[model samples]
Target: MFKLLLRRFFSLTLPLALICAAGFGLDWSALALADQAPPGAQIFELHCAGCHIHGGNIVRRNKTLKLKALQRNGMDNLTAISEIVLNGKGNMSAYQDRLTEAEIQSVAAYVLEQAEQGWK
Candidate 1:
């Protein structure tokens, strides 16, 4: 009986522990600890939420992050949005220095995604 129980424990608990460790239960590597880039939503919250809460632009109400507004303003695509984010336009300040290229792209993609989803 003890032998059977021990075999069950090894087969089940050991594999579960290993799986959990692989899934962050024991991830202490420097690569894991290295600063991972914040997601688009987080970036938006930190840098744009103050001015563009819920995709509504307080500075330029007409130029919101909404899909319709983006389309109407010739910013319906990722390239256009990325350009604005990289260089800024009108009331918006450039984020070229504040964010890495990847981050800018991520934020741009996030904006497009949120816009497509109606910012809900």
Candidate 2:
């Protein structure tokens, strides 16, 4: 009877452990970890700075966006900014495929936390 119970326990535990491992693997794959810098700053440098200008650099002939303008424009929160980065707007191109949801959220958080505070 004890042997049968032990076998049953192993049977259940083995699959459960495998499932958990698989879930973790899937999560790791889903999370984007490409940015070596802050996510928001990286996103801006890669996507926005090209045309909007940033950090005292003028790469294009467009108007620059300061922190205040970014917050007032609804990028004050991570969720809103994430959607914008993922979907893109106006003349901006979408980064949905280029960045994962995690990357978007991280970048959005960084922008809101560091940039918005200075805007006020």
Candidate 3:
């Protein structure tokens, strides 16, 4: 009867639709992650680049990542930078909720590396 046919159609199509949607969602997430630059580079571009272009602080002219500035401000290490990113010290905004912990770690490392290398 039509009732049986309707049940069969629903049973068959509903699971198929769910499976397809799940697959599509996973694929989209993977693609989105892949499209981003490396964790640190991507995070920097998204959050830090506007003000700290090339590791120079736009808001605080004396607070550049140029080795001396970092040492002077006690921000010459990943721990300090990560703390800043999380807590939002001075002119910077907090990214604790906006980014994952892994991302914070990555960008912190990146900042240290860039500073050590003179931002080249």
Candidate 4:
């Protein structure tokens, strides 16, 4: 009876300990780095330029939201941009499901950089 109880306790506790360790490892990985844009500008062209003109698509109806405009609107920072992409505003759709969190962070960084440097 003693051996059986000890075996059962070890079996349950070992799995629980392993599970807790795995969860901590995953959480650390998730928090490891600040999201940055990918190496190329394709993400901006494909996902952002439709409504924002600085990346090069011509504006049709919506206001030409370039880096300058974003700055003027007080949204020319990476964090703001990321939040906007993830949560969306007005006619824009949330991109949390479409793009990875890292991708969104990268694009936001790119846009903020351009805004700060005057889009030259």
lDDT winner = 1
For model 4, how does the per-residue alpha-carbon lDDT over 1-120 read when each residue is reduced to its tens digit? Answer: 999999999999999997998986766554444234353245776888676656433544433346666766567677888898889876667999989988888777877766666656
Per-prediction TM-score? 0.68, 0.50, 0.68, 0.55
Query: Taking the tens digit of each residue's C-alpha lDDT, what string does model 1 give over 3-103?
Result: 99999989999888888878975756754544454588778988988999999999988999999999999999999999999999999999999999998
User: How many pairs of residues collide in each model?
Assistant: 0, 2, 0, 2
Residue 92 local lDDT, model 2: 59
* Per-residue lDDT value at 22 in model 3: 92
Q: Lowest-scoring 10 consecutive residues by lDDT in candidate 1?
A: 29-38
Model 2 scores worst on lDDT over the 10 consecutive residues at: 55-64
Assess each prediction's global lDDT (C-alpha) against the native: 0.90, 0.66, 0.88, 0.70
Off by over 4 Å in 2: 1-36, 55-65, 117-120
TM-score of 1: 0.68
Off by over 4 Å in 4: 1-40, 55-68
Scored by lDDT, model 4 comes in at 0.70
**Model 3 / residue 27 / CA error / Å:** 27
lDDT of 3 by residue, 1-120 (tens): 999999999999999998998986756667677676577977888899899999998899998877889999999988998999888887889999998888999999989988898888
Instruction: Evaluate model 1: give its lDDT.
Output: 0.90
Off by over 4 Å in 1: 1-38
